[model samples]
Target: MNPTRSTFGLIFFTKKANENGECRIYSRITINGKSVDLSTKRIVDKILWNSAKGMARGTSKESLEVNDYLEQFRSGVVDAYQEAIIQQKPLTPENIRNAFLGQDEAAHPFQDLFNYHNEHEKQVLAKGTMKNYYTTQDYILQFLKKSKKPAEWDISQLSYKFIADFELFLRTFKKKDDPQPLNNNGVMKHLERFKKMINMAVTIEWLDKDPFVKHKLKFNSKERGYLSEEELALVETKELKTDKLMYVRDLFLFGCYTGLSYIDAINLTANNLMIGIDKEHWLITQRQKSAKPVKLPLLPVAAELITKHRHDPRAISNGTIFRPISNQKLNDYLKDLARECGIDKNFSFHLARHTFATTVTLANGVPIETVSKMLGHTKISTTQIYAKVVERKVSEDMQALRSKLSRKTVPDGEMIILK
Candidate 1:
C-alpha cells in the first residue's frame, strides 16, 4: 500500500531523565503532521543514547540490542500503517497506533479504569478510599446514561467537554437520602479521583494525551465546622430520646474524644487499646486513611464511652469497641440529634474529628504537635489549619478586653473623655 507520510516514525528518549541515570525510549508516529506517541516500554542508559541517530551509541551489547529494537519499532509502525490502508481506514496517526497495538477492534471501557486501579492499588489504598472510587465510577455510569453517551469509549475519546459535563452533572445530582446536591468541594473530589484513574491509564500507555491537562480543578476554601466545648458537652450530657440517636451520638462523641475518623473508629478493636507510659489506658492504633501510627491517652469521657459500649452485642460481633451506623444514616441521625440538643448547626460524623482537633484537644491545652500525631497528620502545616480556625476568643477574653478598653489611659499631651 502506497501512502504519503511525513516520517516513517521517530524513536526518541523521554524528556525526563531517569533518576536511576537511564532514559525510557518512546516512539512518535506522524502521518501528514498528525501524530500520536506510543511508549516502547523499553529503556537505555542516558550516557549511551545518541539523540541525533535516535539509537544507542557504541558496539556494546545493550547498544546493539537497543538499536535493533528501534529498527523493529519503525518497521512495526509502517506495517501498522499498511494494515490500516488495506482495511480501508483513513491514514491517521491514531489509526496507525491503534492498528499497531491491535486495539482498533477493541477499546478500554472508561468504567474498567476503576477496576484497573482497584486491582493495582488495593493493597496501597484504604478500603474507604476504594469505596469512594466505586461511587465515582457509579456516578460516571449515571453521567453517561443521563448524557446519552455510549458505555464504551476509546481512551482518546475522553475530552475537556466530557469532564465539564461530568462536573455539571455532579453539581445538579443529589443523593437519594440528601436534599442537597453535591457541594463544590465534593464535586472536585470526585473529579480528582477520576483524574487519578486517567493518569494511571496514561502511565500504562493506554492513552496518549491527558484530557485534564487543560482542565482546572477549582475547590472552594470553606471553614470546616466543629462543635464547641459547650456544644460537645451538650450532646454528651443530653439524654437522647431513642437508641438510634444515642448510638450515633456515642459514635460521634467517641470520634470527638479520640480524633479518630469514621473509618478508623469502626476499625478499632480490643487490640487497639494498650496501657501507655502514664499507666493510663490509651487508644493505640493507626489512622486507616494515612496509615500513620497513633497513640493517644484515652480521656475520661472516651474511656467511659468505651466501657459503656464494651458489652454491646453488635460491637462484640463486629470485633470492635464500637460500631457506627452507615455513614449517611449516621449523618442524618446527627442532624436530628443536633436539633434535639438545641444546637443550630447540622453535624456530620467527620466534623467529630474537627471538633477533636479544635475544641476537645487544642482548646484544652493540648500541644499542636501532639495533636498532629494523634490525628495522624504527616505535616505540622496540616494541623495548623485547625489551629487558625479554633474559637479561641471566648467570653472571658472578650470581657478582659472590655475591661482594658474601659480603663482608658490618658496620653501625656491629651486627655481622653469617656463617651
Candidate 2:
C-alpha cells in the first residue's frame, strides 16, 4: 500500500500473513516514504501503529496527533544519534552553546588544551615547572573572572589586542591584601607559558593560528654586575675566620680560579681531577646547565688553590665535594665579606662566576672561545661580552704599528733607500 500524504505522519502496512489457521498481521511504519519496523508490545507502540494505519487509510485528527508525537520523537532520536556519531567532530557554535547552557560534557572549551599540557609536562618537566604552570593558570582564571568570560573560553579568542590589554591589566591589578603593582616579569613569565600552551594547541590542530606569532616578548633583564679582580682580592685578603665564612670564601675563590659554576663546583671533588697525558691536572666534568661534558686544563693557580684547600674530611662527603652551605647563607656571608673589604657592590655567590668569566680569563689574555668553554656557555655570543676587554689589545697593536710606520728611515745616520 502507498504511504500517507502527511509529511510528519507515520504509515503502517502488512509485511506478510502467517500460514496459521488465523491470518497473521505484519506491521511496518512508513514516515515520508521511509519504513521503520514497529513492535506492537506497548500501548504507546499500538497507538502509534493504529494512527499510522489510520493515516494509510485516510488522515484523521487522532492520526495527526500521533504524527505530531512521531515527528517530535523522531527529531529527538536523530539528534541523539547525530551527537553519538559525530562525537569526534569539531564542535559547532550551536553545539557548544547548547552544552554550555545545558551544562553538558561539551561545555568546557579549554578542556582539551588543559588535558594535553597536564600529560605533556607532568612527565618530562620538574616539580618546579608544574608549580609555575598552576601559578600561570591562576592569573588566567583571575582575568577570566574579571572579564565575565567562561573559564573554558575558546583558546583562539586570546587575540593580540586581548593579550596586550591583559598585560596592561596585570600591571595595575592588585591582590586583596596588597596595593602594589603586579610584577611585570611574573606576568610576562606566565604569558610566555600561554605561548607554549597554544603551541601545543597548534600541534594538536585545535587552534588554526598562533596569537603570539608577532608579539614581541619582553625578556627579564639580567643582573650583569660582577666583582672585579681587585675587589675579589680585597674580599680574599681581608681576614674572616668563622669556619662557614672560610668555606664560602674558599668555594668562591675556587670558582673564580677554575671558572666552575656554583653547582658544578659543588659537585667537583678528588674524583673529577685527573692527571692527563701532558702530566697536568685536568677536570673532566659535565656542565650542570647543558649537561655537556668538558675537559678543562686546570691552571697552575687553580691547582694551587685546590691543594691549599683539599676537601677536608669534615666538609667532604659521599655527596657534593665542596663545603655545602645554603645559597641564602652563602650570599649573606659574601655580603658581609664585601662590606668588610669596603666593596660597595652587591655580593652574590654567582658574582664569583662572573669574576671568573670576565677578570680571571679575559684579563689574562685567554681567548674568549677558550673562556666560553671553561664558563660552559653553549653560545659564542654569550662569551662575546668579554670581547670589550680586548679593545685595549687593539689599541696597543695600533700604537705599535704607528711606531713602526713613523720610525726614521735613517739608521746610524745613513739614509735607507726604499726597495
Candidate 3:
C-alpha cells in the first residue's frame, strides 16, 4: 500500500571505482524518508551504466546479464517490503534490507534469547537463581545434542511437542558426573525457564506466537521437612568438641529463630537491625531470593547469637553480623551437629529456616498472615508450605481443650451434661 511513499533503486558507487575502473553496485532502499544501502556484490563499468534508468545502458551480453540481476534484486526488495507490511513488522529500511537478505528479525535463535534473558536477569536475580538458569541452559544444550538437533534453533520451532520431549529428556538423561536423572519438579523448573525465555521473546516481538500457550506446567507438591521444637532445642543445647561445629550450630540456631535462608543469614549486617513499632530489635532487610522486604522481630535466641558474634574479628572486618562461611562447609558441619545431637533426620542449613517458620513462629500461635509477612513471601500460599501444623502441636492444643472441658463438666441425675 502507498507505493510512492517507499522507493527502491540500484546505484553504482563510481566514487569508489577500482583501479580497473569498475564501480561497485548497491541497492538503495528508502522508507518514510529513512534509507539504507545494501551491497549487491556486483561491479559494472561506470561508462556503461545509466544513472536515469538505474540500469546498464547497452543490450550487450554482459549488460543484459547485469540488467537482469538488477531487475531481480529490485523486485526482491519490493517483495520483502510488502511482506514486512503484511506481517505487521516494523516498516524500516534496515528491516526491509534484512528481509531482502533472508535475515528476518523475528527469527531469533532459542539459545541467543536464553543467554540474553539470563544476562539481564543477573542484576535482579540472586546468585543461586542465576546458577539455576545456567544449569537449565546446559541441560537444554545437552538435550539438543542428544536429540541430533542443531545447537541453535529458531524460537518459532518451539512447540508443545518440543516441550514434552524436553521434559522426557530431562527425566531420562543422565550426566557423566551425576548419573541420577532429574526428578519431576526438577524437570519442571527447566521447562519453566524455557517458557519464560519464550515469553520474553514474545514481549520483544521476536515471536509472533507463544509455543507455551497450550502447554500446562504441572508440579507435585511435596511436604517440606523442618526440625521439630525438641530437635531444634537439642541442637541448640548440645555441646560440640570443635570450635567449627560450635560456629555452625550457632548459625543454624539463628536461622531457626529468624527464618533467614542460607544466603540471607550469611549476608546479615548490623545495619539490618532496627527498632520496630514494638520497641523491639528487628531484622529488617530484603530477602535475596525474592527481593521482598522482611521485618522479623529478633527473638531472644537469634538476638543472643548476633550479640555473641558482634565482636568477632571476621564479623567486625566484614561489617556483617556473622562471619560468612562456605555453604558446603556449613551443610557438612550441620550434618555433624545433627548426628552429635542425636537428631536422625537429614539435616541441611535450609531446615533451620523451616524450623523457624513451623516450630518457632506458627506453632507458637503467630498468625499465618504475620508469618508470611515476616518470611518475606509474596503470597500466603508459599508460607503455608512451611507453616504446616505438626501433629504434636495439634495434640497439645486438643489436650488443653480436653482438660478444660473435663474440669467444667458436671454430672446430672439423668444425663451427664457439660456446661
lDDT of each: 0.82, 0.63, 0.82
lDDT of 3 by residue, 138-198 (tens): 8888888888888766665566788889889999999889999888898898889888878
lDDT of 2: 0.63
How many pairs collide in each candidate, listed in order? 0, 0, 0
lDDT of 1 by residue, 1-419 (tens): 24653445555655568689988888888777656777887898889988887788999999999888888888887888777777778777777877877874436887667678889988888877888988998999999888887888666667789999999999999888997998999999999999999999988778867889999999887677889878888988998779888888888999898888887887788998899999999988887777789999999989999999977898898888886467778888889988999998869888898999989887777788999988889999988875544557455567788667756764455645679
Worst 10 residues of 2 by lDDT: 1-10
Task: Put down candidate 2 lDDT per residue, 92-151, tens digits, no spaces.
Answer: 333322332243432336655777798887876655467788777777778777888887
Spell out the clash pairs found in candidate 1.
Answer: none
Order of candidate numbers by TM-score, starting with the best: 1, 3, 2
TM per candidate = 0.85, 0.61, 0.73
Q: Report the C-alpha displacement of residue 343, candidate 3, in angstroms.
A: 1.9
Q: What lDDT does candidate 3 reach at residue 358?
A: 90
Flag regions of model 2 displaced more than 4 Å. Answer: 1-156, 173-194, 204-206, 220-223, 308-310, 385-419
